[model samples]
Target: MKYKVFVAGSGGIGEAAALLLREWCEFETEIFLGDVSEENLAKAKNFILQNSQKTSVVETILMSKDGTNEAMKSAFESCACLLDCSPGTQAPRMARFACDFKMHYANLTEYVAETDEVIALAKDAETGFVLQTGLAPGFINVLAMSLYRKFVEQFENETIEKVGMKVGALTAHAHQPHFYGFTWSPIGVATEYVKPSRVVRDYEIRQIPALSDRETIIIGGRTYEADLTSGGAADLPDYFRHKAK
Candidate 1:
């Protein structure tokens, strides 16, 4: 069946998905609903209309704090997927709702606590909830797994040297600057960035400070500084002990 996807928060990510869906309607149903003020939503809509070659068909909802559950149900009816780009605080609540309602939950959320919570809940529930479904986590995961398999196959007997990954986000457009700008709450962005980061060192999982690893990247005449991210890799310690080296 063609997927009817409901984006739970008509912010930047939601609107992006909506545009992509409109461009690829034969494959998915993209609808954006959120509690953002009407002015914000209208601005989002205008942006879509301006950038998109085709007419953007978006259904909007003004959500209230007291009525989120009902709003979610209403906007989420018949949705094959729920993409939550709401604030970090809302992710856990949305994850629980998705689990309780038997909905597939996907988010671009960066909250380790919330992601961990959802991961725990998924252990008992019959649904799949993915927290890092974009850029760093999503695509990086696929490529990393591939390299992992190759390393295992190629180094079946050799003592592995060191394993590390270099990842980054970039805009294909030269005019656009610095990876991307997601339309999300300032609180969500700040909270995730301010929190400590964790990763797998060898096989051991450990927490690393965020923005601590600064490296320079150059493309043509442009130079930019980037740093390591915190969070993700929660299962490394339980699965392996390669950190002692």
Candidate 2:
């Protein structure tokens, strides 16, 4: 059915997501893009309209930190879902608004504390809430689960020794001293690198230093380095706690 979606950010990820929804959604969509900056809102709206199908109905809203503005309130009440692509710190606030409006909520924040807050806020709610729906925390976790399921089916055994999940966002060109370029926020990369990673060790959840378990591996006949980054495991470690080692 045709529905409305309220997107809470106007950054790169926000614009890209809106474009994908408008171009590929099965039903006609009405999207309200909200942000604090007028420049960003205009840019994001124009970007989506230029790339999406002709039937796309895109509008912009000026959002506040507390979500108290009349325009923001109207959009929230109208939309069926809130897609939060804002900064990680804004996760809980957006989640509160979603719960208050009784709309399905989804976000891409990898911040553990913020994610925990969202979980607590929506634990008893009737509507749906999906957290950490980003690349490493989202896609990689799903892929790991799929691989585990396939292995169990083929081997007919549940005593799995190990399930390794890794991800790297490498730049095409690199130099020494760090040998990395920024595809994402530098602060985010640094935060994940230094934070403790949640892992399953000996059928128990353990917190280990990020970048401590570094190794080299070959993929497609080319050698590359891999390491454990914080929050990438998502909820897999918890799910497989007693099921796999």
Model 1 reaches what TM-score against the true structure?
A: 0.75
TM value for model 2: 0.93
Model 1, runs deviating above 4 Å = 25-32, 46-57, 66-71, 157-160, 169-189, 213-226, 232-245
Winner by TM-score = 2
Candidate 1, residue 72: how far the Cα is off, in Å: 3.2
- The CA lDDT of each predicted structure is 0.64, 0.87
Any residue pairs clashing in model 1, and if so which?
Answer: 197-230, 198-231, 203-242
| Tens digits of lDDT, candidate 1, 73-122 | 77666566677877666877777767766778888766778777878777
Clashing pairs in 2: none
Q: Cα deviation of 200 in candidate 1 (Å)?
A: 3.0
TM-score per candidate = 0.75, 0.93
lDDT of 2 by residue, 1-245 (tens): 78899998988889988888788888878889999999999999989988875576899999886647999999999999999998888989999999999999999877777888999999987799999888878998888889988988999987788988877767889988788887555666787888899988888899999989889999999999888888777778889897777
